[model samples]
Target: MSTDDADHPLTRAELRARRAAEEAAAGVEAAAPEDSEPAEPSEAAAPRASTAADAPEAPQVPAVPTADEPVTRSAAPEQVFDDTPGPRRTPNAGSGTSASTADAAPAQAEAEFPDVAPAPAAAAATRVHQEDPPLVPDDAHVEEPPADPQLAPPTDPRLEPPEWQPHPTPAPVARRRRFPLVLGAVIGALVLVVAAFGVITLLQGPRVSSVKIDAQSAIDASGTRMIITASQPLAKVDPKQVSVSPKAPFTVDTSGRNLGIRFTVPLDDDTTYTVTVKDATGTDKQRQSTLQATFQTPKSTIFLLQRNADGDDTIFLTDLGGKNAVPVVQHEKIDDFRATADHLVVATEKGGTSVLLVMDRKGKNQRELKLPGPGFLSNLQVSERGNLVGYTFTDKGISATSGRASILVSQSLTGDGEPQIVTVGDKMPSIAQWAFVPDSSSALFIDFSGALYVEDRSDAKAKPTALGAAQTVEGISRGTYTAIVSRGNDLVELNLADGSEKPLAASTPDFGVPGTIAPFPGGTLRQVATRDATGLPTGQIVTRVDDDGKATKLFSVTGSDAIMQACPSPSGQYSAIVVAPKLVNNPYDQSLLPLPTTMQTHIVDTKTGKELVVLAGFDPSWCAQAPHR
Candidate 1:
């Protein structure tokens, strides 16, 4: 080779032409027999590319070494191959093997130094396609090396590696499983609906399974309550549809499946009341039924005290039925007495002091209660519950001229403690009248000046609550929510809860108002009234009045007969009317208080207006329900 050609190198086009000729020659040689010796090259093998010296320099190709011939390796430009094969071709100017392909230079450098990682397929592909120059032959002379007998011949184009081809996808799956899943869901939903309907069918009807009541007949001024339980859940109750005989004021409660009947007013004694609930529907509302019950209240009996002018006084027990009349006990100069279920409390005057006694129902086991001081007891009363006995007493002090003051006191009949003085603000008032609050340790009192107070006896030092002013305190009702009071000639019911007052009907102008009020069935009151036109009360009668001031006479007397006072039995079935000879003309107060020389007490059935019995007595009262009775 000439020196200029060696230093300037041949143009790329010349080099490429030489490489193509060499490759064609190799193909021809490879087609020859494997053992045949290679033929000598043509004269073209001689150096001839130096004529076009201004052409771009072509990349040098390193001589390939063979096992038999040790050919010297020239330092050639680095060439990098990619993992994914591209179109095969002889080395040319535009191939990524050249340094002129700037983007591929990094990959070629990495290939030259094996320690460096190869460029990724994506980077090599981008350079070859985007930044590569047009294809041109590389015409560098590459000295042939001696062939190695052990090496296999280059792979033929037709015998290239086979590419992977995807297997034919099976025909689209039939989706047979989806049908069964959808069908199962529908069947399950239908089963749930059927179960719900079956459950509803089983509970289609309403039926009353049992009935329970506090009493066959209401035994107290407080009415009775009845509870009815149904077999299944019931719908809302239409209260107006529930039937009650005698048309009394009542309320019905429907909670869950239980039905309740609350009589706001006491039911008539000795009367059969039928409560019928018809057209009652169950929760399912497929069927209706009628439920009914018949109950009768019990008749009432009272204890009468008869005081003799010259001898001992007697306490008698009698019933409105007139069959039961018996004398229980007797005391000398009996001033007042109260009957309880288990015992009888009596007060008698002895000299200047009053004696208090407790006895059993038959007048046996008489026990005297100790007094705080030598005093005379009056206004004696016993609590329905708690077995407490209370009274007002006037202590004469040490001498006749000593200041005489009245004090109120109470003690538990079952306890041994001395009677406690019912006081207001550390002192007892000179009470004109007082009554125990039913079923509680409380009492309502009115001073002589008509100042009403409610004192809780449980705590001795607790201040009493003032309940405004009143002429007289009749009684406490409905636990402590209501108070029956009389102001002048008008009777009023006071709601102690909110301090509201409601007028109660007065029977007649001549009667003023009965000291004793009998709350009967249908929210009606039966009370004693004067038969005469004079307000002084020449004669006596029993009248029934309603809330609107409508009055009806139930029983009456003629001539000079005077009804001193009337008391209703606990169940309101009967009334004990105390009658005395009229004192020509006199006010009702004088006749009711300070028992007359002799008085006749007649027990009469309020419903039938029939006198059951007549007994000689002064003070009459009914006993509360007791274990001994």
Candidate 2:
């Protein structure tokens, strides 16, 4: 070689080309017959001495001894070299040569000394080797250097070292490396979605989840509870915010996630009631929603007494439709009967005395309820709230100085104790007219001297409360403790709870003065006598006078038929009007409390003034006691 060529040091491409040529020659020698001796490397394949002097010191390879000497292997681990392409190392500033030139020097020296080839038996003894395992397992895939060295792609000198890094050691092949990474990403996404849903739920208003109510209790008595459950905790609700259709008196109570509504009076039967709560909000108060629910009440069942002068007097139970009449109790002479939630109390006359029989609603399981003494039972009534049956009693031969006379008495329906006699001060005065107050254990009565008193049967030792003189107690309202009583010619509303008095409000359009008034939940049923120009009786009008004094005519009898009595239902939705049709011909029965034999009761809707049905009975179960003459 020329001196100038030796001084210039070969480029990386030239060195790589020369190395490829020597490797091809060594492989050819290895493929030759085993018995043939290996050919000596050509002079052109030898590396220049100057190239070795400029290169970095490589790992020391044990020298192979000649055949004339004994061949021996070193105990040290085999030295390995990697040919896989990788990031170029930064060249040291002290070194005059570039990184590519230094890296090529070792390859050039190994190529020049082809005589140092490894023994054929040792497969791992190679100077240049691939770091990666073969991608395909087949003999046809074994790699070899190209036959023409110039065909290889040339490396650029300006190529930068890569920014990414690789593992220090080779890793085993994995068929499912991405499985764990994909699963982790899916789980993280689900957690984010769940968190978002929870935030939305908390920000919204509460929704009604469920509702519960008892239809029987709602129609039978007062204090029926309806529970409404919400999806989340609720805020407090004021009683004024709640409204019930077919309006009834109620109170509101609230707890966590539940709202309770208690009806203070019996609800109308066979009616659809809608309860609505306005501007109901959740505990967070983030949003507001109106809560509403609807439920229907069961139909009402009433019992009426039909008296027969010849045969047996019967007390039959019937529905408002006047159909399905079932005989509940029968006796030779039936005086009066009253119905409670679950049972019936009938006052029957046996021989010359009075007998009180208590039985189930279906008239089964009949049992006797003892009276205060062996006197007659006149006004029989029941107080459902106290479960007590009361009556006005008089001796068989009642006189001014004989047995007990017109004494008021009460007893438990369960027959657990003796009958209790009501008294005012220290005397059991003769009771003239009396009635049990609605939904209470108190009795509003007037003595023979027209003295009015309120006595609580539940409290035996307490003195009776006197509210001056009242001619008669027409009726007492259910939830409100107001009694419609007559004082002289004007009607007055007496507040039994506080003994306050106020004149009864006159109905609108001024329907004149009514003969009798029966107070109910929201109104009063007044029997107004419609007079003609001569100021004589013309017709009887049963008018419904509301608490606001608005009157609506329910039923009117203009002919010989007379409206004997007009009583309001427990809920005041309908009024039961007893009419003696053909009063001149309908003879009076020979009973203690005589009534026209051909009497028919007209069930009229108080609100719309619609007559529901005409039943062949005088006294309706809606009345607290039989109508007084």
Candidate 3:
């Protein structure tokens, strides 16, 4: 785990010195000098005599003393003649040298060299040199020398050259510390190898926790039993320390090897959730992620207002419930009309030509819901499934082609033609502005004036027939198909069996009315959440009717600004809006003057009309990211 410590500063000189020292100490060994020749004993005799003369008398070396110490010589013999190195002619040995030097030199030369005695010296000087007898028999000679306490007789002449030789370097002193050095080097190498392997292993490992889901690939409602899988052990995470948000009320199942959780919600709706894992110390590797069948709940009032900018009718998709104003589409020439969803779709002019563009709910392009030849579709209707599309347009030579539209009924595998007329109807509906019921026998249509119509296309081979105006529209929910409808502020409901209308409630000035209706799968189209006469949200309350047909407020908007366009969060608990000022100097000016300074996106807890988050300059589109596996 340790490298060079980087916490402290090291100067360049210090670093270099440290590196050099490390290198020098890495590989240490004993070194020897080149020469290995042995010297003749006489070579030491001269130095011995000279050293005795020059060196002061040394105190007698201490010895293991007996009761009576043995007599020790004050002056010792210097050397034997064999220990002598260079030519030593003794002519001046007696004359030039002192008498004591003469005496000690001869004795030392004889004792140390062991070859300067008269007989041997005389024979060696007079006779020709010859080899000595072999010490061992040729046939019985041993491979190795016999062990003896004493050293070998001088060195054998057989091993020595018959010439003067330089002094042999003494055998290098055996370094006893060598073993530790070798051991240390080996350990260092091993440590580096292991460290490198560990680093490589760690670098290649994944940093994010893997999450897997068991059982159903999709969740249909809350309280669905499910499992969230993890790659590591679950014990590392403490449930008490962990936090799962969106707080949609759910029970976590931490008993298994992998972390699994169960969900419970008041309303049965699809939701996506996040589960955060923390240790007992409230710390975690990072935040763990998972998703389930959950959606955003729009429990507040939001709006969008079409603004005029750059001589164009700019349509903004927003949550005007607060200080948010997001211009969905802006153009100087094109008429900016809006379509609703997590993603936006619009019909605008590009290069003086009318083109159908299906932008993201935020007015960003996905695929252009394009069509050929258009004066620009005046009315465009998209089905809840986003499959059925209907629009009205005027082509060349067509004078106010009032209600020319096409529906997807014919193209779908399951659809009966719901229309035969190619023109607008005075009262009965015209063109292809209706969606045939699932049975393909009857159809439902929303007129330009926001009136609901039931059409009978059972006799599709013949002319289609109108089922007449719906008897009661009071609280007639698009989500529940059970809401009361109002006729000039007179609210009523219809008895399905008899088709008879009954008034539910009389008009009340305090209760705001509905404008247009949009359909939801199994929920109610609660209310008309918008601005009132004061340019502030007064009718900014959600009105929902229960099974008892009693309508009441589900949530309220407490914002001051009038709501323009309201887009519900996917879960329907939050709303995003675009706000507009009450007055406009020029509705169609090429340059918008003095626009709202803060054009940010606002998010609020729809249940309380309490603001949650505000993101500046960023308009969020409902782009869903689901678990891949």
The lowest-lDDT stretch of 10 consecutive residues in candidate 3 is 64-73
Worst 10 residues of 2 by lDDT: 131-140
Better of 2 and 3 by TM-score: 2
Q: Candidate 2, residue 412: CA error in Å? A: 1.1
TM-score winner between candidates 1 and 3: 1
- Name the regions of candidate 2 deviating beyond 4 angstroms: 1-201, 282-287
Position 128, candidate 2: lDDT: 21
What lDDT is obtained when candidate 2 is compared to the true structure?
0.70
Q: Pick the candidate with the highest TM-score.
A: 2
| Model 3 spans with C-alpha error above 4 angstroms | 1-308, 311-330, 334-344, 350-353, 359-372, 381-389, 394-444, 447-468, 471-567, 576-604, 611-629
Candidate 1, residue 115: lDDT: 51
TM-score computed on alpha carbons, candidate 1: 0.55
Q: List, residue by residue over 1-629, the lDDT tens digit for candidate 3.
A: 11123344432222222222222233321121122122121211223111112222222222211111111111222221222344322222111111111123233334544533433322331111111110111122122221221212122223222222333333343344576788899999999999997675344331223454422212222334445544333444444654555554455665434455554422212344555554321023333333223233222222233334424545554443444555656655333333333434445566555665555555555455535354445434333332344445544334464533332222111222332332225333333244433212344554544455554433334433333344333223222233344455555554322346666542233345554332222223244656767776554555443334345454444544433333344334454443333323213233112234234445654445666665442223321110010
Model 2: per-residue lDDT, tens digit, 1-629?
A: 11113234443322322332233334421111112122221122223111222323322232221111111111222222223343333222232211111123224324443434433321221222111110111111122222332222122223211211123332333425766888999999999999987777676677778989998878777778999897788899999889999788899999999999999888999889999998889887878888888899999877888888779988888888877999978789987889898889988877778899999988899999988777788888999988999988887876666788879999899998898888777788889988888778888889999999888888868678889998888878888888889989888888998888899898897888887888787788888889899999888888888889898877888978888888878778778888888888989877776778877888888889988898887788888778665
The CA lDDT at 205 in model 2 is: 73
lDDT of 2 at 396: 82
TM-score of 3: 0.37
Instruction: Decide which is better by TM-score, 1 or 2.
Output: 2
Backbone collision count in every prediction? 8, 0, 77
